[model samples]
Target: MDAPTNIQVEVSLGRKKTALLRSLKMPLTLSFPPSPPPTVRDVKRAIQKAFPKFYADRQKLSLPEAPKSLSDDSVLLFDAAGKVELVVGDLGPQISWRTVFIVEYAGPLLIHPLLYHLPTAFYRTEVQHSALQKSIYAMVLVHFIKRELETVFVHRFSHSTMPLFNIFKNSGHYWVLSGLLLAVDAYRPGYSQPVVAGTWRDGPLLQLGWAIWAYAELSNLIVHLNLRSLRPAGTTTRTVPVGYGFSAPFNLSFPNYFFETLAWGAVFLISASPAAALFIAVSFGQMLIWAQKKHRAYKKEFGDKYPRNRKAIVPYII
Candidate 1:
């Protein structure tokens, strides 16, 4: 079979000011035929075809003045026009999504336990510890460990490579928040009290929180397993996930995100730090945005076959 004729593209590799190709005595500007109205991936492929040393997986293509790297690989080259001002560079190094998640989750799992048990020089005085604090710590550890395990065994990433810069960003987010939550709860004055001290009135709220957390964690796991089952090993085929086991019977949207939010809500109920609650709010907001996007994409793909009454991340309310 004859190969498809490639479209001509003029690509500038590496940043305008600091071109990596130029440093390596390679051409900064190269003209290659990719495809008509080439996507970012096409440009990368073109570069790799010409210069096999420059791997597409490590490249981070973006506009010169853009605040962040371009995430949309399907964007047409011609549509960029003046906006192109193409600034290409290595995103340090590429890493798999599984590695990223495992590493990110591991930071919190290890750091939290150390901070709780071992007193630092700054926090030399031991605050009165409570059963609730120990419970919360255990829950946090379990949550992150489960996440790491899921990344390894269950979750399937659509894209294999992530920008190396994301490792730092994600690590900072999880690490800082974990440290802050643990430190604030442990060392902060008047913050180490039990959420419910087995009192007749408020003790039930603590029990309810535990129940909700358990349910949410279990439901989230089931949803992940269902999603993983959709794409069998050695295949890229996508199938609509039917509601089953912990999923709402009539809903075809992101039920996992709903359960995830509920789990965090339960965590917030048990937490003494306002920061923890704030973090949950922010995480839920971000999850909702992604869930809504997923919902819309499903509707677009499935048309009338998609469920009509299901909300994005919530059952009846979004």
Candidate 2:
């Protein structure tokens, strides 16, 4: 039998209506091509076309019975009568993931330099920071600047947007720990200074730490580029990252996380600040959880094709 040319979709608002607008009293009737099997995104686009005021990003489309909003890629299900019902929830204010990432990274990028230069802001007095303190401060600036650049040019998110309020939560995390906390600790009086006062002998060790930090930062960027390469432009395809990117001698499920932790660890080594250590510990815990989730997702998606030897967030260890 030939495929149906069009499927009529009945669209209405969900129970949890947005306060931004009153509930859409009249259900909308929209026609979609059946050959392509329209997705939630297509349905939302159709709705947007009909009601120009309702943009796709602010619309959360779902099935009539399902309380959860449908993903943009979800295929529409039509009954035998060639009719499908859809409910849209208003997301109210929404922000693109790209904007969220930029905002989140910008917090640290801006705060770090300010706290470092304004000694009185954090230290409460005019006090000289050790040479190592100055070096680590520079590293902090470089690291966040690189992150901002990557967020703008390199990274592609699977989801285009998120709720508006998440920007504050994410920004606070980076701004507080990695930026304000570490910078204050590093710039504090006498940090990284030798008790014996013998010409600040950590110069040699600081040089070594800087080298390691550079390597880790570069490796992290490579991993991000590799991950980006796995998914082509304008698509959200997940493929097994083999060889240098996600597999091989590293055998770490999330080498990016490992390299990021290593970079932060190098900062701690350079500054010898408790705040830096605390940041590393807290971030490692979070990265480990995310790595474990990603590892599980890989195994679940690829099954036996996934290497059993791969460990999450760590090399050769859990």
Candidate 3:
């Protein structure tokens, strides 16, 4: 079979012009106990109130061009009446880094509180194709927690009684990993006659340790990023880290906001992994030392330009 390509589109009917303007209209009838029939004006007002932006959509109505997709999936579009209109190939990226960022970073903060400490999966060959994939799941959970910290600094305070609801405030900014999964599925879609089953093929015990460590690193990310953003007031001296001009404060830099992201990401992979603990621990431990070294280098070079006593990873250690 020939490989699939990467450009797709989903076509739908343009927004309604008025309450009376429903496409592929279906009529529903019911007997009411002497209630007044609803008028068209009331319907119009309700529609406008619900979707203010769609009210003025005057774009030309036609099917977009079908292009090749990055992933090997057929495209399907639906209208209000549930009919496929235009089916294009990949308009969206086959693999998006932003979605990877959120799933890998911000995921852990939420996961840790909910799912005890250790990772959910064991060394199951059936559930996961390889230990490497389980590591990936843990890794995504780590990033979710790390990135979620932004909820505090970026979002202004609200006195909402529902904390769960607040998490949705800037949710549009999230990277939906499901898209990647769907794209991948499209590329080589699965199901053996629609059968789904998996099992473990024996493994080590330290996976739990790695899982715990993964979540801990996630916890650290949230604190660090939020802390990193809120620098001490009235201290404007260096553009980059104190000594280094543009290079990061640390050797391996991602976003300046999420300092310890890689460290946690490593721990997630190493968790429940057949890898040596000393190796992973040493890696995480060294990251701390490196961060402190960079911080110290910055402080010594710029003096008052940098804050006096800012610990890198641990509270009062470095």
lDDT of each: 0.68, 0.81, 0.35
How many Å off is the CA of 222 in candidate 1? 0.6
Each candidate's clash count: 1, 0, 36
| Candidate with best lDDT | 2
Task: For model 1, state the Cα shift of residue 77 in Å.
Answer: 16
lDDT of candidate 1 over 233-315, digit per residue (tens) = 75546666676532455263788888877887777776645767766777788888898898888889888877677777877
Candidate 3 lDDT, 1-318, residue by residue in tens? 332232222233333333333432322221111123322222223333443432312112234343222121212333333332331111111223333333444533443333222223321112222443434445555545435545344322211122232234323223222223211221121211122223221234336545555555654454444444445433322233322212234322222323343444444333323222332354456566677676667667767865554555444444
In model 1, how large is the Cα lDDT of residue 191? Answer: 44
Q: Rank the models by TM-score, top first.
A: 2, 1, 3
List TM-score per model, in order.
0.73, 0.89, 0.27
Question: Any runs in candidate 2 off by more than 4 Å, and if so which?
Answer: 1-5, 120-125, 192-203
How many clashing pairs in candidate 3?
36
The sequence of per-residue lDDT tens digits that candidate 2 reaches over residues 28-81 is 898877878888889889877877777898888877777787888899888766
Of the candidates numbered 1 and 2, which has the greater TM-score value?
2
lDDT of 2: 0.81
